[model samples]
Target: MSASAKKQSIYEPDQEGLYFPRPPVFSTVAEERQHRRERLAAVCRIFARYKFEYGFAGHVTVRDPEHPGLFWTNPFGMSMSRVKASDMILVDHVGKVVEGTWAVNQAGFVLHSAIHEENPDIIASCHAHTVNGMAWAALGRPLDPITQTACGFFGHQAVITEEAGAVVVERGAGFAVAKAFGDSKVAIHQNHGLFSVGRHSIDEAAWWFIALERACEIQLKAEATGSPLKLVAPEKAAHSAKHLATPFMGWLHFQPIYDWIIRTDPDLVD
Candidate 1:
């Protein structure tokens, strides 16, 4: 490849006229909805691969392209590892499973529904009770920009305190979370866990959740050493976040993981 080809943006075609990976464009709403469902199912499998499951205390959702008020999520009681496109349930904002044989998780519906309802621009959301995320949440604080990875969330994350540890089955609790999540990519609920949203795709939401969990783990380990961890400068951290925390970058980062899951667990498309 020529130097100019190497300098070209990854989103552009190479000198050989080979195109880089990009989000698929669908010609119809049905095709987009199906694509979202398949991606959502793959995200659950990816979460399971990271061992993010804890007795069904997790959910990821993608808004339906045809029905904006209804979203698709894994059925209640289904293992994240076993969720497939067909196993996903379509749920309305009122907590009803409008389509699908399986029931929905009330907590998941309450939280995710409120988010989708309140933020119509958000295309996807994810929440899970991962060990590291919960551990860091116990501190009731936002992550410090101590590393390049953590810097992605520098200005784009919030620490939600209202009803933080409460089971989010109540509409009010859900609304509280939605209010706190204003324009942020991720929120840390005090004494609870991580919640991430994506304005582009399920891939973005899922990848951010995974990245936030790792950030939590890193911070927890660093603070556990009782040493003063050096923090990234505010200006540099902001610049890093601008480039690293974009919705497109989040989606791009998950493509390899999505490919691996679909290739190894082909049944997820069923």
Candidate 2:
């Protein structure tokens, strides 16, 4: 189909600005939890497929709708490839496991809990120790708006070197990380990895992290050639970032990915 024809078929062409149908809106916390769980499980599979899994040294979370003080996360020591919606655990701010049979990772809880607590507007957060993310983060720099995808991070990312390599067992370390993030949705934790926030849903958080990883890979390769990098114009980059790099867009982009995962591995919904 032609581009204009595809747009004509969208549910709300001017409103949503894409070919996707309207997503299922939830009416209750129970419905929201089920939705979040499905997305979280699919996120793990996507992470694993892209080699974002790193010996259980990562986490992603969404605040529990019914229990605001608690959030859901992957089980400690579980392989991202094996994680399922049923295996995710709910944990309180103090790192105590509130539900499920798995234990919580103190560092995961510490880092993510601080962000969730400090930024009430954020709904989800993602973290992982990926190769490109670590390489770019080691330079303690934010992503340059070198490509269209990179612009999603134009002014929406930061670098955090505070307490590098420090285990986040204490709430203080987590708070420091949160403070470093400030108003941005992403942070390059020097010598650690990347962390991205979702203002609305797990889909947004997961997609941003995935895109950030690829963007970092692109930036690293471009820097290695010793050639001066050509970046997008600042004004244009900012404009695109605002319009194309939205929470709803993030959610929309992940729909096909979730569909494919469900088709190949239906157990993720369990």
Highest-scoring model, TM-score:
1
* Candidate 1 lDDT over residue span 204-249, tens digit each: 9998999999999999999999999999999999999988888888
lDDT of 1 at 211: 92
Task: Give lDDT tens digits, candidate 2, residues 1-270.
Answer: 334553322333454345544457889979999888878888988899889988888888998888888898999999989889999899998988979998988877899999999898888999999999988878887888999899988888989988786777789888998888888888899888899988988888888898999999999999999999998999999987886577777777777888888888898898
**TM-scores for all candidates?**
0.94, 0.92
TM-score of 1: 0.94
The CA lDDT at 156 in model 1 is: 97
Q: Report lDDT per candidate.
A: 0.90, 0.86
Candidate 1 residue-wise lDDT at 116: 88
